[model samples]
Each structure stands twice: as C-alpha cells, then as structure tokens.
Target chain A: MSGRAIVVTSGKGGVGKTTATANIGLGLASQGKKVVLIDGDIGLRNLDLILGVENRVVYNIVDVVSGRCQPRQALVKDKRISSLFLMPASQIDEKDAINTDQMRDLSAQLKEEFDFVLIDCPAGIEQGFRNTVAAADEAIVVTTPDVSPVRDADRVIGLLQSSLGEPQLIINRMSMDMVKRGDMLDQQDVLDILAVRLLGIVPEDEAVVIAGNKGAPVVLNGGSPSGDAYGRIARRILGEDVPIPELNGHNSLAKRLGRILFGR
Target chain B: MTLTELIQRIQHSFGKGGSKDEAKSRLLLVLQDDRLGLTAEEKEALRQDILEAIRKHLKIDAEGFTMEFVSSPTDQNKMHVSAPVQVGRGPANFSK
Candidate 1:
C-alpha cells in the first residue's frame, strides 16, 4: 500500500496538537518507518521547537512551494531518529503563503518518499485548517476533556465529516484524579458528545510540559506515561492491536480497594 | 388558618433544597438540517415527521422531551433528527 497522510488538528488552540504530532512522528520513525512531519501552522509554527530541530531549518514549506529549494532541502532530519524528518513552517510568512493546491502537491510528493506524512494543522476552521486537511487521508481531532474544548472539537468533527469523512478523536490532557473527584470530564462524556471513534487518550503529565520546554518529545523519554501512550497511539495508527492503557493513574488499586472495603 | 391556607403554609415551609437539589441537569441538543442542504420547507416537514414518529412510538410522560431536525454532516441529501427526553430517572434503568 502507498503511504498515508494524517492531519493532526484541533479547532481550539492549546489542545496539544503540535505535541501529539511530534510524538506520533517520533514514535512511528522509531519503529523503522520513514516519517515526515509538516508544520502547517505557517507564521505560528512550533512543531520544530517541540521536535528539537528548530536550529537546523534553513528552508521551509514556502521555499519548496516557491521553487526556491527542493523538498529534500527543506526537510530537516532529526538527530535522534534515523528515519524522521520535519518540514518546518515559515515563521515570517502568513497562512496564505501557500495555497491548497500547493499543499496537496507537496503532500503527494512527500508520500512518494516516506511511509507516513503527518501534518500539524493550525487551530480554528480557517484557510490554514482547510489547506492542511486538504491533503490528509485521515484526520485526528484533538480535544481536552473540558466543556469548551470538547464543544469546539465537536464542531471541528462536524466540519470534517461534512467536508471530508468522519475523523478520529483524541482526548488529550486527561486527569484521572480529577475524574475520580468528579471535578473533570471523563472520556465517556467526551465520547458521548463527539460520537466519533476514539484514536487514543493521553493523560495529563508534567513530563510532557518539561519535554516541550527541553525541545524533546515525551515519546522519546519512554518512561513517562504520556510518552508510552503516544507510542501506543503510533502503533495503533500502523494497524496494531494495542490495548488502551489504564488511565486510573497510580491510585486505581487503592481506589478499588477502598470501594470494596469501605463501600464509598 | 383555613384548610387550603394551611396546605400552602406547609408547602412554603419546605425551603429550597441543598446543593444536590440546586444542581440542574442540562441536555445539549444540536440541530443540523442546514448542513444537509435541505430547504426551509423540507426541514420543517422533516421536523414534523420526526415529532409524529416519536409521538407514535413512545408515550412521553414528562414535559422535557424535545424533538428537533438537524443537518447531516456527510451527505447534503440527508437530514438528521434528534430528540432529547429528560425522564425522572437515569436512562440506564429506563426499563424499570
């Protein structure tokens, strides 16, 4: 089969789209698959920072589209992974710098050379969102388990189904402790409202924030729970039957025993 | 006090309940007929059809059941219909 193009997007900002894209790309590349991640956010690009290859970007997507450089020249290879590459977005250019046709052509060309092409889409349902999703074979809509993010994600999913097909859902930054306390929305509530197939659930972890600051994706750390979740998501994307990890955090056993012994 | 006045005074004695009683249940209903590309008349007809279908199938006991016509995200040729019924108990024990 040919390579697949996947777009990681969230309707609202600050829902961890860039982080998920970086981690999933790294996880897939670690499994011996050639992967290329395109930061489609244009002027607000941050995927390079998350991937730890910001200093190596000489050319970007604009250069490739404008014929100033070849696609390979714009692709910055990750030092930690042998088969991973990143096509950084232009920080100075705007969203209209590249049209949908150019993005489609670029994605098609990249698909010819890599096993997977993941596009990090910008937030909001605008031209940038359209351009990035225009070339994707599948789309993953990321949302936190809060009301605002979940509502925005529902709108995004509706748009995707109307424009494309049904996109997969990814619940990011979940907290099991909050769920246990009835202070946070659970995955079931999100699924009930979105009514889409869930791709994965990533728990909120402090290590993810630290990894972001250090310009390293959490999936590379391996010991972090969120990192392991992203690894499982990558395997699932490759059609592996990976089981969803327990999101009960470290208090699952204690909570269960308390419920059994105390009936609370 | 008169008998009727006595009942009213007793009813007023029960003040508003605690935090649990203060918590209200909300149902989010989305109407999507526009996305399906249906004309206004067709949408209205679909809405009427949905209400008629629901009324024909089940007996609505409470005053909270709402029926609406929604647009279909996938195909413009279709319309989505939704109905939200707020019964007294949780839906999991509806059979009882």
Candidate 2:
C-alpha cells in the first residue's frame, strides 16, 4: 500500500512540531511500520538532531532535489529502528532554492517505499511552510493550550481546510495543574476556537528536552510519560483503538479534566 | 430582525474576511433578543433556517461547503460558524 504523507505544522514556532514529528516517526517505525521523517525547515533544520542522526547525514533533501543523489541514497537510516529514516534539510539560507515540483515528486516516490512519511514543517505561513505542506495528504496542527497559539492555529486551520483538508489538532505542553486551577486555557478552550477533531493530547513533560539534548527519542525510554503518549499516538495512527493515558504533572487530575475538556 | 434582514446580516458577516479563494469565508451569526422566549426546538429551527437562508443567498455549491453552529468562542450570547471551502474529502487521519 502507498504510505500517507503527513505534514506537522504550527503557525507559531516552539510548539513541539519537530519533537512530535520525530517521536511519531520513531514510534511508528519501532512498530515495524516503514517510516521516513523529512525536515522541511530549510536553513534551520533540527529534525535530524532530534532523531540522533545528524552526524550520519551526508546528503540532504537539497542534495536529492538538486539531483546530487537519489532520494533513497540521501536517507539516513536510524540505528534504533531499521525501518525508520531521516531526510535532513539543507543548511543554506536559500529556503526557496529547492524545486517544489521536485519535492512533491520526491514525496510521491517516498510514499511508494514507506508506510508513513512525516514532514516537519517550518514555523509561520511562508514559502518553507508551503513547500512542506505541498505534498501532504493530511496535516496535524500542533498548538499549546493558550489564546495566541489557538488563534494562530485557527488561522492555520482555516487555510489548510481551503487546500489540504481537515487538519487535526494536537495539544502539546499541557500542564494539568494550570488547567485545574483555570489559570490556563484547557482543551475545551482550544476546541471552542479551532473546531477540529482531537487527535492526542501530550502532557507537559520535561523528559522531552532531556531526550532531545541527548540525541534520543524519549519514546524509547520505558519510564517516560511523554514517551507513552507518543506510543499511543503512533498506535492510533496505525488505526489502533489505544485508550489515551490520562497523564498529568503527577497524579489523577484526569476525571476533572474530562469534565472540563469534554464536558462529560 | 426579519428573515430578510437576518439573511443580509449573515452575508455581511461572511464579507469580513472575504478573500477570493485564498481567504475562505467564516461567519459568526449571533441571535439576539430572545425576549420572544422561543422553545428549544424553535431556536434549533432558526439556526438551521439561517443556514439555509445563507446558502440560498450565497449561491454556494453542495460539496465544497460546511456550516457549523457552535457556541461563541467569545461572546456568550453569540454563535460562530466558519465556512471554509472544503478541498479534499475523506475522514481525518491524524498522524503523530
């Protein structure tokens, strides 16, 4: 079967789009699903660093697009999962240097070989963003439970709907304590503004930073809560009915959160 | 307001961000003056009625539009509905 191409994008930066893409690609590949992660943020690429494969990159997407190498040759295989691969972006400042038609053709070719192709989009709705989303069959908009992110997400969602399709929402960096105290915007507050299907909600986890710093995905860590969350997201991506684990900063604030977020 | 005025109101609402193809339409239709004390069914009817009125007024096709009556994101007394021109068709598949 041809794989699905998904672009992970958020209008605003620093909302965990790269982390989520890396983890999702890693998680899917770990389950024996062939996956390839693409970093579409040219000149400011970081998906390779997050995947712990930066040092192994010889040719990048730029190389592949420029006909310097084949798409398969440019892919750097992940040591942890044989089925997972990373296609790094170029380091040059020319974001529009790569041919968009070539990128789309590369995505089409990648879709034939891999079961899932994840593209980590650059922040903001610019050329790089257009390049990232040009070939995606679906989109996932990551946002924090805040007013500004939600507002930006709404604008992004509106744009995606006009072209790509119905983009799903993923709430990242959720602090349950803040939600319980009503200090922050809860899931309902986000859904209230951006009307979209709820994909998965990842709790605010410090392990993300530590793992990224160490050049490893936290999903491989058995004791990591965010790892478990990513695993569930990956399984759900595979059409599994995995129940979302109610993770918070510590204890069981889920029942109250269910009432608050879903109005149950 | 009368139904004709209400339809004009809905048209005016969609005209705010009315960009050609790039900026799809979003409408925030609020029903004021509930002093009529309409029943729940009546209120629901009016909501659907307004949607039909807008569709008829706007001359939109069937497949490319979606109108949702949602609780207002800001004003308590208002309802919001964003009608972006739907592009692709199929169930949403969310990736990690």
Candidate 3:
C-alpha cells in the first residue's frame, strides 16, 4: 500500500513546524522506515539546512515539477540515515513558482517509494499552506503555550476542520517551570480550548536551538530530552502506544527535601 | 408587581434554597439561545418574559432578584444573560 502523507503546519510563525517535521522524519527513519521529508516552505525553505543536507542539493521540488529533473534526482539522501531523504525547496524562487498540482504529483510519487512522507508547511493560511496540504492524508499542527499561539492554533484548527478534517495537535516549546509558576498556559488549558487529540508535547530545550544552528536535528542526540520526546512521537506514529513524556525536571528525593526545607 | 419582585416571589416559592446557582445556570441557558446583544431594558423584558414563561410551564413564586447581561468570547454578536432569582431570602447576594 502507498504510504501516508502528513503535513506539519502552524498558523503562526516560530511555532516550530519545521523543527517538528525534521525531528519526526528522523525519528521515523531511525525506526527502519523509508521516510521522505519535503520542504514545503518553498522560497523560504530551511528544511535542508536543518537536516544538514544543504550543500548536496542538486535539484529541488521546483526542478522536479518543471520537468528539469525526475523526482528521484531531486531527492537528497541524508548522510546519517539511509532510509531518510529530503526534497529541499529553492530559496531564490517565489512562492508562486510551484503550484498545488505539482506538489500533489510529487507526493504521490514519493508515497510509492517511502513508508512515510512528511511535508514541512510554511506559516500562514495562504497559497503556500494550501499547496502543502493538498496532497497530505493527514495533518499535524504545532503550537506554543502562549495565548497568541493558542489563538492562532484555534483559527488554524477551525480552518482545518472546514478544509481538511480534525488535525492532531502538538504543543511545542512548553516550559514546565513557567506553567508551575502560573506564568504560562498549561497543556490542559490549551486542550480545553482546541478540543483536539494531543499527539505530543516538546519541552523548551536550549539544545534544540544549538542543534538547529549546527544543522543537525536534536532527535539524533540521545541525551536531549526533546530528542527523546521526538523519538516517542515517531513510535506513536508507527502505531506504538508510547506515553507522552513528562516535562517537569526530574529531581531526586534529596533535592526535593532540600527545596522543602530551604523554600527554594 | 415589579419584575424584581416577581422573580423574588418565584425564588421564595422554590424554598429548597440555594436557588442562586440554579437561577444563574437557567439564565445562562436562555441567554445562549437569545443570540443577540440584549440591552438593560431588553434584559429586563427578558427577565419578565423568562419568569412568565417559567410560570406558564411550572408552579413557583419568585422574590428579590436581578438579571445581568454579559458577553461571550466565542460568539461575539450574542449576549449571556445571568439572572439570580432569589427565593424566600432577605436579598439574593450576587457577587457580580
């Protein structure tokens, strides 16, 4: 059977749709599944950079759509994972350079060869977003715990309900300390408003930024909490009942006692 | 009788006390159905209409009470009317 196409999108910018796409692709690929990550951001593409395959890009999705190269020639295989491949977007081109039909055809072609096809969608509910979602079987929406992000996510959810169907939600960059201090919105509060099934929650880890800067996804680094969370998300996608990770810092009994005594 | 007095008389009849929560919940339900921006005068009319409507449906006496209208974030064009129908009490102390 053909593989499933899943689009990672967010109505607001800086919500980590790209990061989630990269990490999830890596996670799935690590499980011995053939995965293809598509850079649907088009003109402002960064999936290639994040996956650390930027320099090897001989052709992009536009090249395949315009018949300059076949789909196989456009796919850049990741150095670390044999099962994972990336279809990077062209930075110099405009958003209108590629159409939805092309994306649909490309995704259909990829589905034949891979076990999973993940599209990294751009922010905003515009033509670019439309193009990315056109060929997908399902969608994964990424949002932060801030009110603005949640509000934007609600709008996106409404749109998805009207356009696609019920899209799963992923809460990204959640800070447990802020939530404990009542300074940030909690997961339940977001779920109450959105009313969608929770797929995963990624904590606010500094390692994510460092990994992005290094052009390496944190999912490959076993020590990173966010990496482990991404790994669990991948397993969940593969039909494994993986429990969601707890975001609070793990403290020993001595530390807890010390905090209670000192009121720290 | 005044609308406030009628509501109070109804509240007094339902003597099971603690009618404040019931009244608030009932008014919220009605306001949800109204789906319009109800003004103070409109709200007063609604209060009377609701009491009369309830009276026609059931048997009860209402006393000292008030009905307030608020806004809902989900449906911006509608008003949420909350009526605290006090029954058989000195006064229905609605916080707001």
Candidate 4:
C-alpha cells in the first residue's frame, strides 16, 4: 500500500514538535491504521522516551542507514497498540550522519508497509531539518501562541510551501482563560498571522505534561481535553469533517471590546 | 509614563489590550518583510533601474507604470512581482 509520509516540525525548540508527533502517531494507530513514528532528531532523540519505548530501542535510524540493521528491525513496536511502531534516532550520531537521499529511500521503504509514516523533525533550518523534510510528502507545523515560536513557524511554513505545497498548522498550549483576559494570543490571532489551514488547537492542559512525564501519549487514556482534541485531529486526518469548538466560547464581549479598543 | 505614551495607551485600549496585540503587529511586519525579501528602498531602486532599461528599447508611459510584490491570492508563501507597463509607441515592432 502506498501510504502518506508527513513530517511534524517546528523551527523553534521546545514548542511541542516531538510530543505532537508521538500523540498524533498514537492517535492514528489507535484508529486501526498502521502508523510508524520516526525520530529524525538524530543526536537528541526524544520520541522513544515520550513513547515509553526507550529501553526497547536496540537499533536506530543511523544503524538502518549505515546497513548495520534493516529498517524493519529498527522499528520498536508499542505494547499498547500492536499497530503502532517507532524508528528511534541514534543518540551517538550527529544530524549529518544521514543525508537527504538516504532518508528519502528509507521513508519510501517504510511507506510500503505502513499507512502513515510520521517523521518527528528536529528544531532549526539546518541539515537535520532538510533530511526530514526530504522524506515527507506533507508537513504539519506545530507552534505556540508566543511571538518567538509563531515567527519561527512562519519561516518554516514559507520553506515548506516552496517544497511540499502548504503545511497544516497545530496551535498548541493555547490557554483559553488567558485569551479571554486578553493576555494571550487566541487561535484566530495566530491563524490571521500564519494564514494556513488549522488542523487542531490543543489547549494548555496539565495532562500533557503528566503524559509526557509518564512516557505515554495523552490520547491513549482518552479522558483529558487535549486527548479529545487529538482524536478530532486524527479524524480530520482521516478525511472526517470534524468542527473545532472555539475555546473562548463564541467570541464574548471581552474579545469584541478588545478588538475595538486595540483597533486590531 | 510620559503624557504621550499614556495618551497612546488610552487611545489604543485603556490598558486592557495586553501584549498579544503588540506581538501580532510585530509579527505581521516581520513576516511581510521576510516574504517580500526586499525593503521599500530596495524595491524603489530596482523599479527605477527596470524602468530605465525598458525606456531604451520602447516608448512607454512612465507615469502610469506600476510595480508591486504581492503575495499570491491562493498561496500565502508564494510571491509575484507585477510590473504592468503602458506602452506608448512601437506597437508594430513589439509584435515582431
């Protein structure tokens, strides 16, 4: 089966790129689709730890590219979901250990066996980013509401537009209370600036931190708001037209007043 | 705060519209410049050079000349340089 390869990336670090990758990978797998997660951040691998399969990572992408192990052998299967798998990155190798052509070949090989191949790209516009971007057929850019992350996301979006058409956006760590208080940038504000299609908006749920700490994706348990948001994202990925509910509750007077007062 | 600063704040939001607005405005300018890849001064210089070069071969209405770097209506990341000129002379030679 010819599956779709998508890269999850953020130009800035600590903007939830890896976490989004793990959760979305799990979300797609839980829906009975064959999903494989590849940790593209070679030197600093985190997807394995986030997926709670760090100990089971006997081989990594470096070994596969170097011909020490085959691609299928490097895949670490998830205990919870039999369909979910991860190709962990090498902790000892640098980002330049693998080139773009090799990445493209490996991604093509993996796509033959999986329905969705999600590559967790590293931060920055360096070689690591190029390698991951070369492997993907589409892209998903993750960004927070903060200025720095949003600016970097814009840059990454421009690059992806030149390569992979238009990449979808995921606004993470969005705090509804702050948006109501006019203290934070809302989803609309971000969309206005980024001007891309929104895949999902994950709220600032404390459960995300707890899930990361526990080495399990938030979508696996299915109780938290973030999990529900990811489930909707997965449905959207599967061509389901699920409407995203606004967190600010239908644009109250605070938002209108703020808009008029600020002349925004 | 100074009187001018306080008045600006009052005119904007009465101290209620917080840093989010500031961030949005700043990001807008930065992204526009980043996508355009040229400053106002640089674009003016390039336009003048192009107009001079065009005037050497054909007669054109320099007053009605327009050049713009616009984002594509369909694609946000793509940019198009539109320089529509009104030619005044040489309709026969231009056809060749």
TM-scores vs. true structure, each candidate:
0.75, 0.71, 0.74, 0.80
Clashes of 3: 14
Tell me how far the alpha carbon of residue A122 in candidate 2 is from the true structure, in angstroms, after superposition: 0.5
lDDT of 1 by residue, B32-63 (tens): 43234467787667667767667665544335
lDDT of 3 at A146: 70
Question: What are the DockQ scores of the candidates, in order?
Answer: 0.05, 0.04, 0.04, 0.21
Error of 1 at A40 (Å): 0.2
Between prediction 1 and prediction 4, which has the larger TM-score? 4
Ranking by lDDT: 4, 1, 3, 2
Model 1 DockQ class: incorrect
lDDT of 4 by residue, A1-264 (tens): 989999999899998999999999999998899999999999999999999999999999999999999898999999999999999999999789999999999999999999999999999999999999999999999999999999999999999999998999999999876675456787878888888999999988999899989998899988899888888898899999999887642355665566445544
Candidate 2 chain A: worst-modelled 10 consecutive residues by lDDT: A247-256
Candidate 2 local lDDT, A162-232, one digit each (tens): 88999988899888665543445556556655678777888889999999999898898867878888888
Candidate 2 lDDT over residue span B1-96, tens digit each: 577655543432322111211211122221222223467787678767765765654544445444434445454444455444333457532221
Top DockQ model: 4
* First chain TM-score, candidate 2: 0.92
Candidate 3 lDDT over residue span A100-181, tens digit each = 8988998998999999999999899899889988979889999997756766776777778876799999999988665543
